[model samples]
Target: MLPHDDNPLFATFARAQIRVERGEGVWLHTSDGRRFLDFTGGIAVNSLGHAHPHLVAAITAQASKLWHVSNLFEIPGQERLAERLTEASFADKAFFTNSGAEALECAIKTARRYHYVNGQPERYRILTFEGAFHGRTLATIAAGGQKKYLEGFGPKVEGFDQVAFGDHEALAAAVTDETAAILVEPIQGEGGIRAVPEVCLKGLRDLCDEKGILLIYDEVQTGIGRTGTFFAYEHSGAEPDILASAKGIGGGFPMGVCLATAEAAKGMTPGTHGTTFGGNPLAMAVGNAVLDVVLGEGFLAEVRRTALLFKQSLASLADRYPEMIEAVRGEGLLIGIKPRVPNGAFIEALRGHEMLAAPAGDNVIRFLPPLNVTPEEVREAMRRIEAAAAELSGRPAEGAAEGAAA
Candidate 1:
């Protein structure tokens, strides 16, 4: 075996030490026989949690028939998935990809192309929020406008402008005649679960309409019922001309989609864009299976109910341990807690309690549980969180003193 410090893989992520053996529902079983309640949800990718029977059966069935066939041929599954997605959203067309970054890239291209077709090729610049995170690709990193992700990536890509997050004056001032679109995330997941106000979303749509520029929403993390709605934008009442979605869409499968209005996609004619392994039969099968569950009767309502309970529980926990938790933020199952203690320390403490969570910017710990997470699971997570808080505050857990006396 490789020495602990002599790994062949690139040292990019500060990965945890736990080795997972398998996962089922909201629980993960580690190689060392430890069971962990999973709230990270594979960074919001596992919509239905690990080993969902429907997803597994769909992929398995598709794998037996066809695994891959390039975009050259007309894939029935891809067409059906696209049709369903467009029918459900504000888009008339859909383009498939393999990751959220690709979806954002495609959305960017579609926005620029819309202006290009109108005989204004110079109007290619796009405006983004200061703390936004589009993706890891060079173009997307530039679009995100985060210096940390752009620091070592050589010269930043051109034609992207950024404005202070939620600063309406700055956002309006940044828009120029050359701007093709304004890109935003309805709920900023990586930026610490910060949600844009519904009023601000409507104002952005008005500005885009008045300026004759398209509005693009990067719903990579907030789409596919991660939020109470099918898309977070559904709560804002402002529809984007283009939308980029991934993450939970495939329920852990590697897939993405860029949806666009018919008018916004006018320039994407033949030879405009394409992909190789995107929208393969395997991915389409999984994506469809995910939709079958997410769009099922009363599924989204259940998600809303569970999210409310979870958030209320977290709020109460924060109230009880003000020294450990500063604030509870976010919508639906995509929640975050700003802690008085260091986020890393809190995350470590939670891990010690056999509950997995993810760290975010702004010194927050995110809890992205499955949409179908049960009330019992929420209570169990709350117990673990309270234990973590007690340990962090240097106090014994609820029953620790009684157990010791016994």
Candidate 2:
């Protein structure tokens, strides 16, 4: 039962009716004293899991030192974090934001500005793909070109062209002389965890290079070791001129970054664009702490190991419960399962069994476990999933016999 009071919240979110009291590691405890295995990881934001001592300590230390300072002034923590980020990746420069949406906005602006400053002011249109989720800003919504998101938002933002998700021929045909850049997600997390093949990514890179256009990768969900790699672009060998990363970058802190090559960022002069709270000391502290753990010795390799173990279990579950699951897809910890049943019902079933999962496009359920989830917890998650399957299919439980196979 939901609380009956004068609720001041907006109706935008169709939220779960439970109130979480606390979260620790891989579990969330509700106000009613129910414990749930939180595989959602706060929709892929809790990279280091809940109440991580390192993250908490970083925040505490930074709060005690300094909380924020205008971008007009020098911020040592922000400079240090930027250096750390650039040291690990291909970006020659980095700009901070408060969320993935703003990072994407900066990426878009950077692309157009690059062409403008390069004397190709006509090359302002960006070629975007279908089934891509960029962000909620007006420009980003137009980039996605989804009617559901753009509905009632009259007069869509200009300078964006849409193409089918994996159709290289269509993409090539769609590009014109005025194209400024091509944008895509290496792994479409919200679009049912659909991974653009390595070959396709390389093809996009080739196309952009041939056309003298910038290549942008929206790694907001696939970055920060979510997909077994530091960035999904690493798996494809297709580096972007500009990259947008968030969700896991702050290990639950609200922060995002736009990474760009030296050439791509030439147009963003000191006053061209800025954010007040983008690189504040508090967020930078958490971001640096997250990078310390993610880019540490053998940390990503361990994440890959754990992801493989968990993915194999999911594949086993799909094989055993064909009536409930149609397919298992995605890379690493960003796994998606296309279920034969309604996605909403499946999510609710998981919830009923003391587990939490997120719904994605194309009737898929996403399992975003913590990067450091123990093997025992992975097995337990599988057990609960099996139980949910049994309940959904109206069959007697065979989980004990099937758990070993998983």
Candidate 3:
């Protein structure tokens, strides 16, 4: 055995035991030539699916022209992307970063600084929701306040107050005079695909407005058309003063964006915040490509249509295997399967059937298929899921097939 055979990389991630060589569309290929239907979509990062021609062309074209430059200089691609982002959303200004963590960091800083410069320096605390995942950064982890991610990370960063998820009374009570903002995920991606109800989101907006506090949405996992809209906030009709977006924004390229209203961004002066490698030409090029596809006519409508079909199919599957599946949750293509079996075992069963899925909190298995996934692909995924469930039940494939035909 080689020295690297044991553990060459950090032991942080419990990666699936598959060695992926390349991917195209919704399929992953192993070095040994095995193909797996990938429903994870790289944890919702592959917005346009793997190796999308437009994204590839954009990245290659930019690679041939310009790549990285200091943020001190003006970047036309960044400016164009920022313009497109702001124009398509409720934001008036945009800031770029390399990942969702940095985006959230910018949002946290922007919220605090907004209060600071507005003569309310004491209102630095941010109220966050339980089961919400912002990122892994110290500030974001502290904002999330999940003990699993906060363990042994030293004293938790201050100014983050956590309230029970979706408890309007608790949220209202948690807010103090020191609260500068309320940060939340429109759809709790890692918190088992729990989407906050529209009423609750509107209530949060009302609370923030009443308290003179900012409202921030961490749309990292649910943004960029994953939820059949440009951002998940669109579903609730509640607009945030600041929004953090990443993941699918660059179509698998590393990128993050912090969008804010002009009033909310008053404190983000030249020296207040900056990034070195963010919004590079390469990342901006891919980001533009992703926008071209996502913002195209009929694209998001098709995503909604496809998501409805997928969700109905999943609902039928759950009905058929009630003993195996507890429920199907989530919106658009970001789905979660709450199974009666252990989520890890359920995911392994899907892997055994050569299908990829992601595991989430609360024993949920996430299905983050690409936004452009075809209707045929959704049907195929349902078949594979049924097969996996049958396998788990120790039943022959034909038995399940006959029952389905009935």
Candidate 4:
């Protein structure tokens, strides 16, 4: 230990004991050489699983040539990735960032810019929803409207107001003349896996239309085929004017994207917004590789079919453990288990069963296995969950639920 053992600069997360060494597919190896099934999938970042051949090749190829370059030059990888992103989704333009928070920041900027460019500078307020998880940035934390994360962050940023997550009436009331947009997650990943109803997204879209406000979906955890579709809104058939994407975008690499229509992006002039490492060749190459795998022939369809198996399996588990595991929610592989016991207990119980799961807000455990997880793997995961449920039922000694890994 250093002479000053308690360096205040370090974060509280240093309490974690395990040090992961390597991972492949759905298995992670810790420094102690214990193998664990990675149902968390790095909290849904490793969509293709750890060290996938495609991602490895992309990173290696890019590393051998170029790793970092300023955004001044015309990077081929960025252009290609931008084209792919715009083509795959309902976006006319794309802005790259290095993380989810940055993407949300860019989305907020784009939304306000949309109104500003259209001669409505007063339309700067962004209306977000309660239980929403945007990101860790100051603006994003304020925009998220989750009180737990806002602690000690004195004086929240302005231009953000929030209402009930699914209350359309409160949402409508929140949108005033100065409201720039309504931002939400199609599925609230960190908010206990609560999914906004399709009707809710549709209503928000209609509201945006009537009020001439922009709509933004924080798809950081639900995008990149994490849901049944490439984007969750595809299932609802609702589109957003501005969208923030990250997490699984680069499979496991640090990559994010803020997408918008050309009209909404007009205010993003040359000097308006910028990120040095956003569109670096390395990130773009990895993002392209991820896109290639997710958009491959029938890959997404397999995700849907596998999701069906997972949902059915979790539902059956819930049936068996009526006193322990209750309801199952979320879309595609982004599944959650609302346990009768504390969700953290289930997470710890699964550790002994050689499986790992992430806990979300509220008393829920997220089964965010990789998108490429096979049916057999899903069954195995369910078996582990059932076993964990049985074990957790016996553990009356431990109290308090799981903390969110999301």
Report each candidate's C-alpha RMSD, comma-separated, in the order given.
2.1, 1.9, 2.2, 4.3
Worst 10 residues of 4 by lDDT: 397-406
RMSD in Å for model 2: 1.9
Which residue pairs in candidate 3 collide? none
lDDT of 3 by residue, 121-140 (tens): 99999999889899999999
The local lDDT score (0 to 100) that residue 259 gets in candidate 1 is 96
* Candidate 4 collision pairs: 344-402
lDDT of 1 by residue, 1-406 (tens): 3455798887787778889999999999998999999999999999999999999999999999999989889899999999999988999999999999999999999999999999999999999998899999999999999888999879999999999999999999999999999999999999999999999999999999999999999999999998899999999889999999999999989999999999999999999999999999999999999999999999999999999999998898888788888999998999989999889999898898899999988998999999999998888888888888888898875632232211
- For each candidate in turn, the TM-score is 0.97, 0.97, 0.97, 0.94
Where is model 1 more than 4 Å wrong at Cα? 1-5, 398-406
Evaluated against the true structure, the overall lDDT of model 3 is: 0.91
Query: How would you encode candidate 2's per-residue C-alpha lDDT over 1-406 as one tens digit per residue?
Result: 4444556776678888879999999999999999899999998999989999999999999899899888989988888988887877889899999999999999999999999999999999999989989999999999999999999999999999999988888999999989999999999999899999999999999999999999999999999999988999999888999999999999899999999999999999978999999989999999999988999999899988888888888888888888999999888899888999999998898888889999999999999998888888888888888888888999855754455222
The positional error of residue 383 in candidate 2, measured at the CA in angstroms, is 0.4
State the TM-score for model 4: 0.94
Candidate 1 local distance difference test against the native = 0.93
lDDT of 4 by residue, 223-315 (tens): 999998999999899899889999999888888999998888889999999988998999999999999999999999999999998898778
In candidate 4 the C-alpha lDDT for residue 194 amounts to 91
The alpha-carbon lDDT assigned to residue 48 of candidate 2 equals: 87
